[model samples]
Target: MRVTLSLFLAAGLAAIAQPTLAETLSFTLDNQTPNMIVQFHATPADGGTRTELLKKKGLYGGQSRKLTIADGSDACVYKIRAVFEDDSFYDVRDEIDFCENDTYTLAD
Candidate 1:
């Protein structure tokens, strides 16, 4: 009887200790501009200055990268910025719905 009780308790504890899975928003970036390096950033759409995701490692022309936005809430829109090697940049402020699209292409 004691052995059975201990086994039941252990099984209960193990079930309680199981961790929950977290939801994540992810996307892919494709650099189509020839001869230009690319860097990108993802920020909240609420006009705050906090950068939720940044890729400073640089992506060469024709390269692609996958990025994850760590927002677990119901936020579906975000600000995106792409910086080129020539100091020129493109900004999309609060106009992207990341939940519906998973791929972004950077071109001239």
Candidate 2:
């Protein structure tokens, strides 16, 4: 009986130690504008300081980068902003459902 109880306890502990699965949002950025440098930013749609997903060195035309955002759930949305070499910018506001989209492209 002691051995059986020990086995049960060990099984319970193992289950407790297992980590829960969290949904994550992942996507690729594609640069389609030729001869321009591009930088990317991401922020929570509800409102927060922007986080630079890409910085300093920029993505050139025809280049693509893969990014992953963890702890993303259906309840949350994100805003993505793209800055160009000429100081011009374009923003994709809170309209993005990250879980449903896999790629973002920057173009002229």
Each candidate's TM vs. the true structure? 0.64, 0.63
lDDT of 2 by residue, 1-108 (tens): 999999999999999998776556788988888845556777777776566776576888889888766633332368888888898888864467677788877777
Candidate 1: 10-residue stretch with minimal lDDT? 46-55
Cα distance off (Å), candidate 1, residue 60? 1.0
> 1 in model 1: Cα distance from truth in Å?
45
Cα RMSD of all models vs. native, in order, equals: 6.8, 5.5
RMSD of 2: 5.5
- Model 2 scores what on Cα lDDT? 0.74
Clashes of each: 0, 0
CA lDDT scores, all candidates in order? 0.73, 0.74
Write candidate 1's Cα lDDT for 18-83 as tens digits. Answer: 875544778888888884555577666765444435456778889888888775444667788877
